[model samples]
Target: MRDAVGRRTFLKRSAMGSAASLTPTGLLAVGAGQAQKPAAPSERVRVGLIGVGVRGRDHHLRFLGANPRVEIAAICDVDRSRADFAGQLALRGSKRRPLIFGDFRSLLDRKDIDAVVIATPDHWHSIIAIQAMEAGKDVYCEKPLTLFIAEGRRMVNVARQYGTVIQVGSQQRSDWHFRRAVALVRRQRIGRLKRIVTHLGNPGTTSGAFINPGVWEPVQTPPEGLDFNMWLGPAPYHEYSPNRCHFEFRYNLDHSGGRITDWGAHHNDIAQWALDMDASGPVRIEGKGGFNKAGPYDYANYLEVHYTYGNGIELVCENEHGNGVRFEGSDGWINVTRLRLDASSPEILTEPVSGQDIRAYDEKNKSEEIPGTDEHHNNWLDCIKSRQRCAADIETGHRSATVCHLGNIAMRLGRKLEWDPDKEQFVGDAGANILKDKPFRAPWRL
Candidate 1:
């Protein structure tokens, strides 16, 4: 299970003098994950845009369009209107007319494209990114990385095999505040790390449902201008529902793990980053919550999960815990979110970071804008040029997503489960093991 890079779980003593344990799952094995250098393109890197919905149009297109060195080579979406809108937006500031396609494969077929921006729903992230990388294109994929834990593992293997540059869209890793917080934790400024509290918002309701009705809604015909089957790629086929497609899809378990993976992908990721657990995850998870038993939305609603890491650190994921990561050590604690950072003592944030202090992944020229001017996206573009690792690399994304998946599994199963992080499997639960991967609809396989 050792990867292309020589990364392995290392035993580190907590301030309390306890050593962390890791499973032999081979996930810690890290090696050179970079793809062999592609033939260098000209000054501007050519990119293919996939899933031109809200995030695709707003964040990716706007940022790539703003960058002088990036050309939107192609745009693809199941929805024709969204694709056309993104194509027109991508055409701005570039001499080359961007190609518009209804399918992502057509965009991947173009040798002119060097990389891809994947803003599709959670279910589509793994497949499209893997296909794009296999086609010799680097990828910038949105967060959570996969629809299931197995998909995330497969994604890591494929990326390593292709030597492609893949960055997960967890922008907090590139934030100055997050970096500083991680550095301080590594420096033991907060004494020894003990526990982390993460706040992810509540699971949302399903489309066109009032409560848990326990009855399947009648399937509806596909909407005009949208390819319903294509949109459900790799997922179990069901009658089309407007709520199952767009932004509301996150609340549906068929496509996503709801807020557990949605916002958990963000906040729990920070907990992993600060605790140096990006390459590993929890050894025990126990959760309980309310499910949408009466509504069309089946994802968990009110959920709370407690995770215990190999090193005896506890991570609590809950609703209303406040939206951020709070690291509690022996001396004090520091909490950080998108809004701002608050610490038990001001000195934690004020202390000067030393050269030897643990630092977050770095951009060669921090001052120069990367592709999106948004630090996380920019890191990926810069890595494409330098063949370096992005802030939220594939491994990091997989590990973090696993935490969320494990929480969902624990809650859904209504049990306290023992996990072997190294083995990446349940200790003894046969039923839990069955959930690592899911059955996709016919004609779609990973």
Candidate 2:
């Protein structure tokens, strides 16, 4: 039986660098080569939505709500009702009601749609985004850019090859406070950065044998209106259980990377962004955690991973404190989470950032007001129209997500590992490198 790791070699040999050569210029020529030709500023663009579950609904609300320059042209979901609900929402009080589909492929077939917002599960992000870009549509994918490190690199390569505006949904990068915090640190307001501590809180355990709810038993039967097989696309097939689907999917290793990837995709992303380590990542990762027995979920409930960068910056992910991020520097340390920012120097938080400090990081446009809005959704839309990169592009998202995944891998292996960002593999440990990618179910190639 062949594993996913072996397939990487096969893909690399067969493609022979074809995937890497698909540069922006080449992709533009293939898909929207003529997109550069100016059209009317008021010209409306159509969008298709894939995966209308929790985050997907939020995407629909934003795009269909205001944004007069774009329209929701289609919606797709494994759950029929969920897709219909989104379509209805888009149609409400509009001249055009978007078409609904159970399969994203059908939506991709429509030439009227110019882009897609993929809010699918972690495992499905890369494949769907790649296919959408190949089909000539821009993509706005939810954060943690890829399920695995290799997938992240592949997605980045594919996006560049297709010349599509791909945005990773790490909205905190767009937050005013977060960006300001990073800017201040980069500007040396905090002096030489020493160590950055990130707290993701505790994810706890998801063990103990528990049967499914009465309505969802019988093993063979799936819930009403839900297409379990479609939802499991690209992921190995498993028994349909509500606990393993939807939001709860994040707790499982096979489907998601638990809290490390779930919340880390958001908070750790800022840690990486603040450090200005978008293209590169930690050279070392070591994990310490325990797990629970029973159930298919196999991930660390509590983990503390230490990452070392070449610049002498140490990033620590601790599960002890509440969820937040802190940047420690020689002058002072600044901590910013979802709520507030705190520092040793009271002036750091309140003192108006000077023009000199802002110019140091080249963030002269940094505003006291919350930076960008709509959770970075509007940024993507505006970029699509202007033909510019989104705030959190694929490369940025991938690097941040890679940090989370690396932490999980180190924790699982219970040892330290050296990482090669350019090659995207573990240096000497073949066993560790094998975890870089995962096996896909048959007939669902990425």
Candidate 3:
């Protein structure tokens, strides 16, 4: 009852909820985890981490390793150095040695593991998540859930088909201020929502970005401990370059959608949730991009995308806004980001929720305590035991990722596109449709 839109308020009025058989019981299932029967503390959730890179080790390992009700069974990465490094940290921190794996499948093959956390590159998310779900392991996958729109659909379908308990790594959904921001917007604290703006930073300037005027990165041999071929699974093989791996991989079209899918996946996702369009998407989109003119840098150097939602709401994504989401309505506006939350009329943010007010608007929050702004990992663990959905469930993630993909498609094709969100296709453009999915490089099939 303490956070944002209390459960009943959320399911009934925001983000939509439940259906026939396949749909989630609730979109975020906000407090649904605690409402169900509790799992004994001794019943630990055995987690296997699939990528030991920055986020995998820094966040996932840090959080999961601390939870008393979870055990990190293994750590896997294409890069042995990363895997071993994180594994050592895990051992020292948790006082338990976890198996280290070069290939993700080795971790997935272990029947002892109950869930997998995928922090691999954008291209590897779909295949690894799909297999994890099919193997009956719940998943906590990082943002930009899929490399392509088609892959997002496949993830959603496979999640439903397998009854997978998945949590997308759009961690902001579980942050306290964001939860309150979304709740206030849904409650009309800002009046009828008119427009939303997100200031996602420039995509073309990632530290080691290869195409920035004066950089010469030539093909190099794969690093000693890395299995480059396995790392390239599903993506077309390209000669190794320092720019082609780690953080820099995002700037490449073959592996990512630049900031469009990277940062857009986060801010755009929050925008979708604020608009209560988690199950649906925009009807029209167009982009104006300062694409690199004389180089192979496929991503736009400066990008701005405009989307018109079915409810006649407009969302603009660009770099000028300074890295946060601002929701503007008829009366006032509310702004939020990981670091801060402020509003045009501060009174709306300062207003306190009374005990009487809680019962009048929402009751599910009265029934249970939703997992608060922790790492958002506990919500997944709780949902796994409760058999409920998470704060960032698969469908919600797919829809958010779709918003990113749509913007990327518009920018790439340099056209105004009409989309049928329900049908999951471009209205009439064959070229746009063709880009929905890319053929996975051989041997790896969804």
Best by lDDT: 3
RMSD of 3: 6.7
lDDT of 2 by residue, 237-308 (tens): 888877788877777777888778887898888888777787889999898965655445566677789999
**RMSD in order of candidates:** 9.2, 9.5, 6.7
Best by TM-score: 3
Q: Is candidate 1 or candidate 2 better by lDDT?
A: 1
Worst 10 residues of 2 by lDDT: 24-33
Q: Compared with the true structure, what per-residue lDDT tens digits does model 3 show for residues 183-277? A: 77877888999999877863323122223322447889998998888988999999888777887777777898877778888889889988888
Lowest-lDDT window of 10 residues in candidate 1? 6-15
Q: Candidates sorted by lDDT, descending order?
A: 3, 1, 2
The lDDT values for all models are 0.76, 0.73, 0.78
The candidate with the higher TM-score, 1 or 3, is 3
What residue pairs are clashing in model 2?
22-161, 176-371
Q: Which residue segments of model 3 deviate by more than 4 Å?
A: 1-42, 202-214, 294-297, 353-375
TM-score, one value per model:
0.85, 0.84, 0.86
lDDT, model 1: 0.76
Worst 10 residues of 3 by lDDT: 354-363
